[model samples]
Target: MRTTHALVQLALALMSAPQERHWGYELSKTSGVRSGAMYPRLRQMLDEGWLVDGWETSEEAGGRPARRYYRLTEDGQRELGALLRRAESDSRFGGLDLRMA
Candidate 1:
């Protein structure tokens, strides 16, 4: 479940972004995860009804539109909170840096 924890941490970090929309590449870079790993995790989150994704046309970059954004669902937020609490309670995180942001 280490990957799952990483994925959830990535999602939480993304949620901290000021922008409402996030591109896949941006997420991958910020999360320190390669596209291969990030994309599958994202797909899993979507499949689990924990995320919503949408595409948008962008003229600034080029004629080609960027497959655009992803945001956490209400369920995702709830799950994140639960995960944070669990991690805080668990001794595995060393009980030093388990506080959730």
Candidate 2:
């Protein structure tokens, strides 16, 4: 997929806690991406083998449905690093802002 500013922001956010599993809503909030954009981008990443996803399992939790969580794979980390570096040198992305919520 082509790298956009939003993609860079999301990648950075995921890399922020590379070892931790992140849920959709939390990722949306932290990455400053709306739900509409975040979900589709996440699915695209999964399809491209950049992300691994699974449902959260909690036995102690009251009967709530499991939430899907995502973690960046090794390849994802490498791809993100390259993308971020490219974006840093690209003047088009200079005006973009990534604010963590």
Candidate 3:
């Protein structure tokens, strides 16, 4: 995937909770990326097989509308880690700090 600031932020947010599931709104808040920019990036990640998504059942959501959740796949974890490291090294990224778990 092409590296962009918003994408890097999103990757960091996901890396912060690698094993936990993430949904759109929470990702937006955590990444500090607006929905307009975030969702399209998410779709690109999904298309690239960097993420797997599933819907939370209404019961699981406490009877609210079913919400979609995303998690990184094994390949995605490795790839994102590499991406973060690369971003950290790139002067364009402005000294990004990367320490992914």
User: Which candidate number would show the highest TM-score if scored against the true structure?
Assistant: 3
Candidate 2 per-residue lDDT, tens place, 1-101, comes to: 88876788798789888878988888988878888777888989999898999987776234888888999899988887778778877888787553322
Off by over 4 Å in 2: 96-101
Q: What is the lDDT of residue 19 in candidate 3?
A: 81
Task: Tell me how candidate 1 scores on lDDT.
Answer: 0.67
Better of 1 and 3 by TM-score: 3
Cα RMSD, model 3: 1.3
Per-prediction TM-score? 0.70, 0.87, 0.91
Backbone clashes in model 1, listed as residue pairs: none
Tell me how many clashing residue pairs each candidate has. Answer: 0, 0, 0
Which residue runs does candidate 1 get wrong by more than 4 Å? 1-5, 58-62, 89-101
Instruction: Residues 3-80, candidate 3: write the lDDT tens digits.
Output: 999999899999998888999999999888999999999899888888999999878989678999999988778888
Query: Distance (Å) between predicted and true CA of 43, model 2?
Result: 1.1
Per-residue error (Å), model 2, residue 60? 6.1
Model 2 lDDT at residue 78? 85
TM-score of 3: 0.91
Please tell me which model should have the higher lDDT, number 1 or number 3.
3
Which number leads on lDDT?
3
What overall lDDT, based on C-alpha atoms, would model 2 receive against the true structure?
A: 0.82
Cα lDDT of candidate 3 equals 0.88
